[model samples]
Target: MERTRRSTIRSLAALGAAGLAGCLDGGLVGSVRERGGDGDESDESGDGDAPDEGRGPPTADGSRHLAYDLETLREESLSGGVGTDGIPSVENPTFVRIDEPTLIDDVPVFGVARGGEAKAYPQYVLVHHEIVNDVVGGDPVAVTYCPLTGTAQGFERGGTTFGVSGQLVNSNLIMYDRATGSWWPQMLATGIDGPMRGGTLREFRVVWTTLGEWRAAHPDSLIMTDETGYARRYENDPYGLYAPLGGYYADEETLFPPLSDPEEGHPKSVVVGARTADGAVAFDKASLLVERVLSGTLRPSDEPVIAVADPALSTGYVYLNPKNVTVEPDGDGYRVGGDGVGGAAESEGAVDADDLPLERVLAFDAMWFAWAGFYPETGFVGDHTGAGYGR
Candidate 1:
C-alpha cells in the first residue's frame, strides 16, 4: 500500500477553549433535549437498567485497569455544553465508492475493514456527528471520534446504538448506550456511571490515515458520505485542523480540564496506543513513521510489546512479542526472524507490517494528554517525547 505524500497544513485559525466550546454550547440544546438531559441528571446512582446479557454490546473478559475508581470518575465528569443527543449519532449512515469527488487522496479518514467489508469514515464528516451507528460486514458497530481528545475508535454494538452523552471527563467524549443507558467514556470504553459499570466493550482497530492511503490498501472500500440526515459544515472544524496542525490540536490548552495531568510531551502529540486487561503502551506515532519499529514493555509484568509502522497506511500496529522477535524495516514491509521465532535467527523474510508472526494487539491513534489522562501509568516508547515504554 504505497501511500501518497501528505502536505502538512498550518493552523487555519487560532481558537480559545471558550470560543471552541461556544460553537457548540447550548446550540440546539433543546431541539435534541430529546435524549438524556444535559448529563446533569441527578442520577449518581448508576441504576440504569441491566439489559439482557446479549442486548448490549459485547464485553471484554477483562478491561485495562482504570487509574481512578468509578465514584471518582463520576465526580470528574462535566458537560460538553450540548445536551444529550445534541451531537447525534448517524443511525442510517450512507457510504459511497471512491468515485465520489470529495474522496481525495490527501483527505483524512479513519479506515476500518472487517469480514471482507471495508469502510472509510472521513474525519471532516465524523467531527460533526462524532458517532456513526452503522453495520459493517453485517455486524452492528459504532464508529466514534472525539475532536477534543484526538481519538477515533470502533466498538461492537450488539442490539443498541451509542449516542453522545454530552459529557466529558479527562477531556474525552462520553458515550451512552441506548439499551442499558450506561455512560461510557469514549477512550475508556468501560462503563463507569451506569449498570454496565466496570464492563469493557469489545473494540476494533481504526486507522487514522489519509484517504489515498486507505483506498490504496482497500480500494473497493465504501466511504461515509455527508448524506447524513443532519446539516453541518463538514468542511469546517471547530477545534482545529491537522494537515499542517492548528487550533486546539496544535495548542497546549484544553477545552475542559482532564482528570489527571502528566507533563511528558506536548499534550496533543499523537501516539499510537494499545491496551489490554493487563496494561497499556503508547508509541509516538511520528517516531514510528520514521524509525519503523519502536519497542516498549507493559507495566508490572515487563511483558514486551513492539510496534511496526505501515508506510502504506501511515499507521502502526502493536504486537505482543514475548519472544522479542526481531522486526526490522524491509522496504515498505518488515522482516521478522530472531530468537528462533518466525524462522532461524539467520533467516528473515518480508511480511506486511499489519501481520507479523506474533500476536497482534489492537492499537489506535490518540493524543498524548488523553492517553496519559486515562492510562496514567502507561508505558511510552519514542524519541519524540520523554521516556521510552511505565507508571
Candidate 2:
C-alpha cells in the first residue's frame, strides 16, 4: 500500500519514547496488578486475561476489564466454536482469535484481530495502548494484543493505505505480534454489521493469508507508535485515503533506540531515521545494518527490540461479518447489520465511520476518549496519578 507521503512524514516526526517510558512503565505495573487480580478471583490465567492490577477497584464480577488474553488466546479456527448468542454484552465489544503460524520474511508471526464494522485499526501504525478499545455498534470494544515485531502488516483497505490507529477496527481479518503476544483486531466501518456477524472463514482467515505472505518477505519495518511523545514527530498525509479527510504529512523520521543487551539496559543514545522509500539510516557510519526487515532482508538478531519491515497486507473493500447466523454457505452472500457494538455506536453520536476526519483521528484527545475506561488498571493509574504519582 502506498502510504500518504504526508502522513508517513508525520508518523516519523511522531516517534518518541517520552510518554513511552511512562506508558510502558505504567503498563508493566498495570499488567502485574490485573494479572494478579485474576488469580484471586477468576480461574483463567494468561497474558490476554492478565488483569490490570493498576486499574479501577475490582468489579463485582472480578474481571480485570481487559480485552483478551495474550498467553492463553491460542490460535483456533471458528469451524465449530460457540456463536455470539451466548457472549455477554461488553462496553468495548472486541473479537478475539488465534491463527496459524505463518512466515513473514522468514520471521514467524501470530494473528490477533480486534474491533468491528464501526472502526478500522492499523497495527503498529498508531501505537497507543497495548490493548485497543474501539466502538463497535454503540458499545465499547477492547482488544488485547502481543506482536513479535514492534509493528507489522502495512496494508490498504477500501483504496486507502490504512496505517492509521482506527481504520480496520471492525474489519474481519486481523494480525498478531508473535514476540510480544499482541493481537490486532481489524474491521471496516464502511460495510457489514455487528459483533454477532463475526465469523472465522470470511473475516479471519482472509487477512491471515495476506499478512503471512507479507511477513514472509518484509521483516524490518517500523510499526506506528504514540504520537503524543516529546521526541516524536507526526505528519499529515494528503493522499492518505485512510487518513481523515483533511490529509496527513510525509517523510517521517525518528531516532532509533541504542542497541544494548537486555540485562545491560539500552541507553537512549543512538539516533536512527527511517523513511518510506530511502529506508533506515543510522548516524553511526557502520553498525549492524539491515534493510527492509519486514520484507525479510537480513538475519534476525537475538536482540528482542530489533527494527523490522511492515507486513504488507492487501487493500480493498472488506466484507463485515454477519450476525447471529449459522456458519454455512449462502448464495446471496453474507447479510449486513446486527446487534453488534458497531451498529449501536453508529446509531449514537460517539463516532461516525463515514465522516471521521484524519486530523481528528490523529488527535490523541479524540481517540483516547474512545477507550478511556478500558482495563481497570488504566482507571487505577489515573487515580494514582491524581493522588500524586511517583516517578
Candidate 3:
C-alpha cells in the first residue's frame, strides 16, 4: 500500500495540476502566510516589524511604481504547490573542504567567496531549496537560484532572511523578506510589493561553474553538503537533466509569457548579463566560446567589462576589466591575468580571478527572454550564431 501511494505521487508529478495538489496534500508545500495584517505601512522604523494590514502590498499607483510593468505581473501565474518557506532555506548550512570525497567534480555549483571563506552550493540541492541563507566573512548573504531562468546570484541580506514567495515575475523567483514581508523579484533585486517597495538589495558576485572548476579555483573553499534539515530527493531533478538535453533548459519556449517580446534570441538562450548604474549588457555564451573573451565599454559607462567563457563547464563570468588583465585558456580553468591563476587544488588562497580589485558589478546568467523582459533596452554582445542551447 505504501509503495502504491509513492507511485501515485510520481505519476501525478508528471501530470501538472494533480501533481501540484498531491504535493500540497503531502505537506511538501508550506502554507505559512504573512503574520500581522496587510503588509503595508512603511517600515522605516527598521525594527523588523510586520505591517498591520493584510497580505501582499498596497496597490501600485503613481506613488508606488514597479521596475517592470504592473499589468504584466500575472498573480495567477504563481506556482501554487510551493508556498512560503515550502522550499526551505538552509539556515546554518554545513560545508566540506573541496577535496572531500563526497562531491563530484563535473556537477554544476554556485561558488562565492569573501574575505577568505569560500563556499559552493550544488545545483542538485538548489533544485530542491532555491534559497540558502548563510553567513560568509561575517556578512549575512542569501544565495538564490531560479531554475527557470538558469540564474544563481548572491545578495547581502541586511540582517534579514529571504524565502520563496512561490511567485514568479516573468518566470523568475519572487523572494520575500521574513522581516518586512516585502516581495522582491530575484532578478530585479527590488522589493516590488510591500513597505520595502522600490528599495533595492545589495548584490554579491557568485560564479556559476562546475564543482570541479570551483574546486580547482578555491582549494580551501567549502562545499555545501546534502544534510539540509528537510528530507528531499537531492539527486532527482524535477526540471530534467543538465547535460546533452537540458530538459526545460533545452526548450526555446518559456513556461510563462514574458513582458518583453520573444523576437530577439531564443527564449532559453543562455547569456551572461551584467548591469551597472547606467545600463545593462548580455554576452551570448556560445559567442564567448568562439571569441574566447569579449570586452568593451558598455554604453552609458566609459569603464569596460569583460566576459569569459568556460566551455568545459558550459558556464561564463563577467568582470570589470582590470588593468593589464587578459582572460586566456589556462588548462582546465581560465586565467584572468598574466600571472597564472592555478586551479583550486593547487591555489593557496581563494581564487581571486572572479574577484578583481575593481568593483564586481552585479551579474548573473539568465534565459534570453527573462533578461530581455526585465531589461528590454539591454545591449546584447557576442555572435549568437550557433544553434543556441535549449532550442
Top candidate (TM-score): 1
Q: List the residue pairs that clash in candidate 3.
A: 37-53, 37-54, 38-53, 38-54, 216-343, 216-344, 217-344, 250-390
Q: Write the per-residue lDDT of candidate 2 for residues 171-253, one digit (tens) a residue.
A: 11233221222223331111112221111101121121133344333332222222322222223211221221111111111
State the lDDT of candidate 1 residue by residue for 49-146, as single tens digits.
Answer: 22244466656543455566666666667666577898888999988896565555777889888868999999888888899998988878899998
Candidate 3 residue spans exceeding 4 A from truth = 1-80, 295-306, 309-360, 385-391
TM-score of 2: 0.20
Cα displacement (Å) at residue 33, model 1: 35
When summed lDDT is taken over every stretch of 10 residues in candidate 3, the lowest stretch is 17-26
Which candidate, 1 or 3, would have the higher TM-score against the true structure?
1
Candidate 3 residue 331 Cα shift, in angstroms, is 10
- The predicted structure with the larger lDDT, 1 or 3, is 1
TM-score of candidate 1 versus the correct structure, residues matched by position: 0.84
Instruction: Rank candidates, TM-score, best first.
Output: 1, 3, 2
Q: Which 10 successive residues of model 1 have the least lDDT summed?
A: 26-35
Per-candidate TM-score against the hidden true structure: 0.84, 0.20, 0.71
